[model samples]
Target: MCEHMRPASAFWSFRENISPSALSVTTDGKHTVVGTQNGLIFLNSRGRPLWFNKKIRKVADVSVSTKSGKIAVGSSQKVLYLVNLKGEPIWHRELDSSVIAVSISSRGNLIVVGTDLGKLILFDGKGKKKWEVHLSNSDFPVNSVDITSDGEFILAGTDYSHLYLYDSNGSVLWSKETGSAVLKTCISSNGDYLGYLTSDCKFSFCVKNSRMLWENTFDSQPLWIDMAQTADFVSIGESSNKVNLYNKSGRKVWGFANESSRMGVMASGGGNVILGNKGGIFNYSLEPYLKRLLTGCKRSIIKATEENLDVTESRKIYDVASKNFSNANFSQFLINIHKARNLAREARVIESDSVPSERRLERNEVEEDPIVPQENTEDEMMAKLVQLAEMREKGILSEEEFIMAKSKLLRI
Candidate 1:
């Protein structure tokens, strides 16, 4: 068996008074922009807070330019602000509906905003309105938006369960019905792949042709998702206060948990990840994890071969790992090596038990699903109902909204 190794830990982290509603990491991983319930924050690569702005109230989304570090923020108050690195607003625009999402190009030359009014608007770096398109009715607002690094492509998801891809000029390239409300969406840096999460708790990845590569469903609803530059890695934050990393094939590499709720996550092109919430901003690097995994896999294969155990499957896996390593695809190399090590271990067990070749166990991949919270009891449900009623009385919910929510809560 291979020796155990230490796991990755946060490189740097710090807390704020408010939980982050959204997170955006630059392609180079040098900067991060966070949208909080009551303000916006900018952090450096070392996790030092550079500046904070309380003027951008109830920030729903944030995006940072990959090359220029320009920030575009969307707020629930129906305002979109383009801010400079020093946290000063360069320009602010008010829309007829709530601004829900924003994405800025690499050079900070283009910006896109998705609104509660179901409109997708594009603006130049100087805040000029380039074009606008209404993808759905007001009831089906655009919930997420993403733009390629070069600003040549844009992707948007809606509450109506639709996903649309558009060129730089706002022409629709294609549209697909996702069959569930798309909570969030992201495009790869080169626009080759797209990732999205649905209200049904399913995370999916697809190619430019709209072919779904793979998908996984979680019991706990996801709060945020971001894809790496080439879509080689995907990261997700969940309401369960956990962050997970998955590879292109939908295999989870690891999960990080914390005491506080994790509401936002971003995966940088350089294989770095950042997670944010009321607890703090946590940064992590995948290098350590992948290195240990690769080392352990090599050891396991050697051990199995020395013990004269069946090494056919393990050899094949190792061959693939060699190819990935030759190509400098470290992520895929480590993943394949991890799989090979598991197979090698299984071979040892089968050989020691003298299991017949035909009856050899086929190892099944085990997935660590999120822990589901306990269902509320009658009294607890009653208390929640009372709280909902109080919120409605305070005008937090319209009559139609309140009735709909109550019905869903009561299963009536």
Candidate 2:
């Protein structure tokens, strides 16, 4: 599982006095909500605290609604609290037993709670009980539960080595008996894929139309597991002090090992992962190449600015790139960084030949009187026009910038 390990660095990390008991992240990787013995914590992508509430005693589990940004908190105190992103409580319920697991739908319209009393309960967003299913008569607690994004399906794993899938109406679709107690379960956003872990050190994935897509046996029991919205990525935190990520093909994408135990692991659609234990919560990016590109773009912009180049557009694009990078939106970050780099190159070209230090053009003057090469062959002029077109196509230049660059290149 560690064979394809790639180097990963945390963009940010946060620590609390108590080890995080539960972790949940949104699909965009913008918000991460953590639960500890002290309370519930809402964190931004940069590991900065948005809000914190210490009223919930001994939080056992937490879940976040990806679409609506609602949070559901389950505590060992036999209480469930529904809170907003601002940490203000919307509702609270005292259950018959301690809550072992909890999950909220993507839209925050439904919720499912797993209790130590062997009861799996479903509730509407408004705190109305929809239904409850008794897993076993012998108090085999439900260890883990997950619901589809639309709240149409629910999956639950129990201490009795039983796994059950049910419809929103509380009718069981199917159930399986694992070799051992099921520790964790995850469902893809569309309910088309399922991933689970059993106490037997087995990790399994199955598709909707299939029995099981693949299974892997680990040397140690995996503590927590999560999947991306599209089912393209899965991640696990193990008792072995390692966190491993797997792609849809069941291939290991990367592995991160640390001295401290991983309390939980979560995967987001934006190629971001968060794993933590007693030490702290750590944010890691799967696409480190984009990070390097962003760094290079920043460097290029700095060099262009130092040469007294009119890099106003480049700086604006670079700021957007930095923000996207901080938010773990690697795809948008890549696009913006490339635009910034292209603009920086063009600025360097204009500054190198057009303006001397003493007679540098004002910002408005530069925009009004676009730089035009004093001497250029027909081929050179065509090449410059093509470059401007490329910049326009890539969103490096605005419509006005494109028109101005074109007019300057062809002397129109």
Candidate 3:
């Protein structure tokens, strides 16, 4: 299934090391290379560790070439190590400054590193120097670097707000002033698009030729951004709330909200995206885009049942969706929920005029059982409000969830 249409499933999650900060993940086909403050850990598709290298302390960055399955690790100790799937070192390069960023090409023929001294170095697969570039404006340090899958384009971002694009022979293609500081940057697998997030909280995208395709500014101050292999979409992870999804055209497609700020984001060949944080990593859907659609379906189903429009079918579908909402098999649940949504939409069409109010239903307006009497008096509503407030205060629900539930109670 194409990832943009495939339903998402939450898969195995692994906790970050005790340090939590300075975390990243690299995907090399079937292997996942995780870089933490302490060391490098390799995991398989099932999130099982295949091998680990604790010898490199304070691993600052990691890159994995999917075509060649070569793993690159950069450390604060000013060293870069290239290893294979079995965790065997192929070569090591000691640099002049602490390594801050690293990237590997798809076939593993190209390697690039960014350092605290504002130097960008490129190396061949055999550890031979290909080219190097030094930036005088990288005073804030070289924080992020990336190379195209075919190893044709190179990108480096610094805290001084300068972004440099390089060609295969180490010549500067172009440079731009993005923002006060460049937080992160990524390149599409085919080398057609480049995306970046800035310290001032702006996420922007550009074509390979440096023409601005689209740009978006955010208040969440996203921590990381990555381009999908197809360059059709980008994912930005915010420090406080949602991990947002945007298309190359700058359309906001989806947002996955969590309590914590995930550290890094990675895209898969199938368009699936993974997020890593202290609580572990989570897999979220990129294709089917059902989260919003499902919510609308639930609202429509309730309205249809209350208006007596194909009541039997609407209620049946509603019941199934309610059960599916609690189901552990999320991928299957999404598929089934979508079917239920179709039923709800059909039911609404059968009796469109029955609901004269026509106001879009709020989250609080939908009754789990539309047949149940919800006409509570104001005093009764206050009592329920108190009840919900107590539940929220008791830590029985997340603050956001509590607020939503309370809003629903007030609607009653």
lDDT of 2 by residue, 263-351 (tens): 66564464667777785887776665345456667766676788888899999999998998887675466467657866877777667
Tens digits of per-residue lDDT, candidate 3, 1-412, equal: 0112222345666565544434434442234677777677777767777777878778888888766868888888999899987788999988889999999898999999999888899999999988777875444589999998788989889887888899889999999988578879988866667988888878878777676656777766787888766664577775544666664445555655644556756543423455666757555544444334456566666666776767566556656655654543333344455467556655564456632122212212332222223446653354345434443454544577566666655554
Best by TM-score: 2
Candidate 1's C-alpha lDDT? 0.73
Best by lDDT: 2
In terms of TM-score, how similar is model 1 to the real structure? 0.68
- What lDDT score is found at residue 337 in candidate 1? 70
Q: How far does residue 45 in candidate 2 sit from its true spot (Å)?
A: 1.7
Better lDDT candidate (1, 3): 1
Model 2 weakest 10-residue run by lDDT? 360-369
lDDT of 1 by residue, 358-383 (tens): 11211111111112122346533553
Those runs of model 3 whose alpha carbons end farther than 4 Å from true positions after fitting are 1-9, 20-30, 137-139, 290-412
Q: Residue 350: error of model 1 in Å?
A: 36
- Candidate 2, residue 58: CA error in Å? 1.2
Clashing pairs in 1: none
